[model samples]
Target: MDSSDLAYDVFSRQCSSRSTLEHVTGRWGALTLGALHDGTFRFNELRRRVDGVSEKMLSQTLHALERDGLVLRDAQPTNPPRVDYQLTALGREIAERLLALIHFVEGRQGEVLKAQERYDAARGGL
Candidate 1:
């Protein structure tokens, strides 16, 4: 397909970009991408780094990212097979942007918590 024929509107239900956006922005996707940004990692290492992610979810996330061409999975034919995941060039680009957002959120976490407290108090919620 021609580049100009591509759908740029993510708001449209039929837009393919929506699926890509979903994969990139999903909870597992975000965390997985963020962790991979540091360097390539084995499955268990990724699990530890992501924290609270289940093996099934991690596997699913990795597969999806790989399918999206954001992650490259390399399997070595060692006696005890070893598989490592690293971000592709495209993955690195998107991961950098996502990491920036993550850093911003981390930096503003205190303010965000305070805002949430105020919002909850207004709604009579703890």
Candidate 2:
């Protein structure tokens, strides 16, 4: 069977879904998506909410997510030209899943930190 006959496999290096996964899971992308999940926001507002993401990086992330159909950019014609961004339906679904993973990781940080400490100590003598 050829690729068309098979499901989209992210494990395949040539598959396009892998890139989308990166956009949804990367540091800035994940943060941006998660913040947007709460509500729509303008560029600066989103940057503030995401925190620590540089303006350039956030702009690139938004552009990528928008291209992936996971985000909607609403540009209004006004004195200053307001531009707001919100997750698309697909974006919402993706964000929901990402949020679950984020919460899970956050809740387990204590255990993760302990493991990290142990790992560092084990290698300290090396």
Candidate 2, 11-123: lDDT as tens digits: 99998889999999999999999999999999999999988999999999999999999999999999889999999999999999999999999999999999988998899
Q: List, residue by residue over 10-113, the lDDT tens digit for candidate 1.
A: 99998878898999999999999999999999999999999999999999999999999999999999989999999999999999999999999999999999
TM-score of each: 0.94, 0.93
Q: How accurate locally, in lDDT, is each candidate?
A: 0.96, 0.95
- CA displacement after TM-score superposition, residue 86 of candidate 1 (Å): 0.1
Window of ten residues with lowest summed lDDT in model 1: 3-12
Provide the clashing-pair count of each candidate structure. 0, 0
Reference-based lDDT, residue 11, model 1: 97
Give candidate 1 regions above 4 Å deviation.
3-5
lDDT over C-alpha atoms for residue 53 of model 2: 95
